[model samples]
Target: MRPQENYMVIISPGLLVQLMERTGDGRSVSVRELADAAGCHPSKIDALRNGRREKSTIDEALAIAKRLGVDLLVLWEHTGRTVPVPAEPPHIAAVPA
Candidate 1:
């Protein structure tokens, strides 16, 4: 993968910041450190932290939630975040006469 070309996950910066403040163990962590721990780029973390992103993959979200000691579903719900996945259409098999 090329630099700055990684698939970044979107997330709610406000919610994340809230969670971090509430649960960050009183430890000040940098964006680069968080990104390193989350297996993403610092820009991705910064984007999510600064309200520049809106969506995130399950893995990334889970990692972040774990770091903040918050439940993924709970945080997602609090953030008003919804999955962008389209509902799978029902399959209809053709019947031969």
Candidate 2:
């Protein structure tokens, strides 16, 4: 079987709570509403908001970010062991006399 790539979307609980207070309409959105928009359960939203959880799937993060009318970076950050890039090889240029 092919190996699957696993990624964790780490969110800022404090920032999430703050953003939820002021949506695009300048009104607060409920947990249930946000959950519906995020295609998850209200408890999940509550857990994240209350700092009971910190990690989420990419889809949930995107949906929450979209509903909040902000970029994904605003609320979540992608952190993990990065694959290092190999050093570039030397390029030889031929010069004409």
Candidate 3:
């Protein structure tokens, strides 16, 4: 199996927490601040940060990457290395099963 195929990769919760901690703007920012900037809800950010959520959409991930000032692909690569998400997109049918 290809490396991407064999490994299931995802961004770690700690990474998000670390990013939030590193913001260092003096004034405390709520999860909403980060999530809104990242185009998602505060709860979503909290979920991801606390490990209550497992996965996020590509758009959501991209938004977070943008807010973090990192390339989306690079973040994905890092997440893939650390979390090992599925290399290939899952197959889904238009028609309901």
My TM-score estimates for the predictions, one after another, are 0.59, 0.73, 0.57
lDDT of 1 by residue, 20-59 (tens): 6666576655677667767888877776787655555566
Please rank every candidate by lDDT, starting with the best.
2, 3, 1
Give me the candidate number with maximum lDDT. 2
lDDT at 4 for candidate 1?
A: 31
RMSD of each: 11.9, 15.3, 7.0
Model with the higher lDDT, candidate 1 or 3: 3
Q: Give all candidates' CA lDDT scores.
A: 0.59, 0.74, 0.60
Candidate 2 lDDT, tens digit per residue, 5-60? 33345456888888899986688888999999999999889978877666666788
lDDT by residue (1-97, candidate 3, tens digit) is 4343232123577876776665434344568877897687787789778876645667677777667655665444434445545333234213445
> What lDDT does candidate 1 reach at residue 74?
58
Candidate 3 or 2, higher lDDT: 2
lDDT of 2 at 59: 84
Error of 2 at 67 (Å): 0.4
